[model samples]
Target: MTDVNSRPPSGTSMRPRNGAAKDAAPALQAVAEAERDRLIACAELLFFAYRDFTSDADKVLEQYGFGRAHHRVLHFVNRNPGLRVADLLHILQITKQSLARVLKQLIDEGFITQRSGREDRRQRLLFVTPKGTRLADKLASLQIRRIEHAIHAAGPGADDAAKRFLFAMIAPKDRDRVHALIRLPEALDTTEHLEQPQERT
Candidate 1:
């Protein structure tokens, strides 16, 4: 006469103290612990990889009395000449105040130059000075050698896999924009054209 769906009375227990549920708890806990260990391993690997990747550049920057921020600003400006301030802010995803501080140092040090935008005089366009270009190239070469060695050690197809992995790490909403920003030939090309002396009037 008892309904199967009825709840147990307030004073009565539905599950035994040593039931199947209690027995499975340890198994679930073990699985969770294993997964956490795997995650920690991956995290540590990424931390070490990034540390080594940037170490060479960090040493170079120190000689100039600059930091990573200066390196990033110089790199982008050198690669994308006439880049707008607004675009740099968007690409770097940093606040105007932070950009201003690093930017002022580069400008005062003769590593960067700003010109009024032809389309909008109110807008400031960024360009790397000759000194900036040399420093940027040197910094880039150091990093490139490290990357080439890593890729070579990883063997064929490793470069493509690494690129895919990095692209996938970008947020879905921002991926398209990132692709557009990074896809430009001007950004990647370092050829005779770039090495040509600027024609000064």
Candidate 2:
């Protein structure tokens, strides 16, 4: 006699209803975590690399009582003589007030000169003085040495790989503008100087 209320299950499966899905979830989670960790490590390396890369020029800038803003202003003007102030603002993507402060400092210190554009009198054109040129060259040489050393250590094709990586890092919308700027004749011509010492005047 079987008592329904006291009956015991002789054979019953204990597995979860969707055991396969449950197992796959943890595996997918592990892969996602690994990828996140790898990306974070790469980002940290960039931070460290930038710190050391700027360390050399930072010392020289400190001697002149100038900061990174001044260095950037000097570098661009030295590279692109007679650049428009508007164009510079676009390239830097900083507020006009900020640029004005740095520009005034450089101009007052005799490191930079400004003139009216021939075609547009209202347009301010910028250029670096000979003194500024020397400083810019010095800063560039410092960074260039570090870059060349890194490239050598990275082996063949490293330069191209680095350029591609950096280019891809830029925002998609701005990539075309950046590409055009670098492709300018002046910019392209200056590329040769990065590997050679600029003549002292």
Candidate 3:
């Protein structure tokens, strides 16, 4: 066994002092500590970035008398055309009552339309109308531009790095759902379509 007392002095640790009493700390301990610190700092950065990223959309939603919840419902439904109510609620993880209220308002506003499923009478398939498409297009356009600018600033490598980081952050329970989404051809195709009003060419 290699003596634990031979570590290079250049690499000191910020962890609790117990590991350092000996001349050399375990190399693995240093690596773990560095990773742990990076994760913590990255978490804070993600929190701040998400807040700033959503602020513009929040303002637009407020003008339409909707909230972030409504934007989320519309955006997902818009992306996945003909999605069922049950599946939507599952993805959103919101109570039926809450979803019902938002769905009702969106339908009433002519932003979304619901059609009965041919196979299952109880199932309702939803889609966004031209009006909703317009709004969603605008909202999405802004985000696309933001993302494009970010990519330009950081170079294409950053986009792949960001995706890797995001995939790693998914909770174990949500991994299956995320996998299903990632495998979607349409999802990948439209992911870059992030415009306020997507051009349907």
TM-score of each: 0.79, 0.82, 0.73
**Number of clashes found in candidate 2:** 0
- Write the residue-wise lDDT of candidate 2 on 1-201 in tens digits: 777677457765545559787998999999989998998999999999999999999999999889998998898889889999999998898999999999998999999999998998999999999999999999999999999999999999898778766766666666667777666334233232233334644
Q: How many residue pairs clash in each candidate?
A: 0, 0, 10
Q: Choose 1 or 2, whichever is better by TM-score.
A: 2
Off by over 4 Å in 1: 1-18, 184-201
Ranking by lDDT: 1, 2, 3
Against the hidden true structure, what lDDT does model 1 obtain?
A: 0.85
Candidate 2 — what's its lDDT? 0.85
Q: In candidate 1, what are the lDDT values of residues 49-151, reduced to their tens digit?
A: 9899899999999998999889999999998999999999988889999999999999999999999988889999999999999999999999999999999
Q: Of the pair 2 and 3, which is ahead by TM-score? A: 2
Model 2, runs deviating above 4 Å:
1-17, 184-201
- lDDT of each candidate versus the true structure: 0.85, 0.85, 0.80
Model 3 poorest 10 in a row by lDDT: 189-198
Best TM-score among the predictions, by candidate number: 2
- Candidate with the larger lDDT of 1 and 3: 1
Model 1 RMSD vs true structure: 12.3
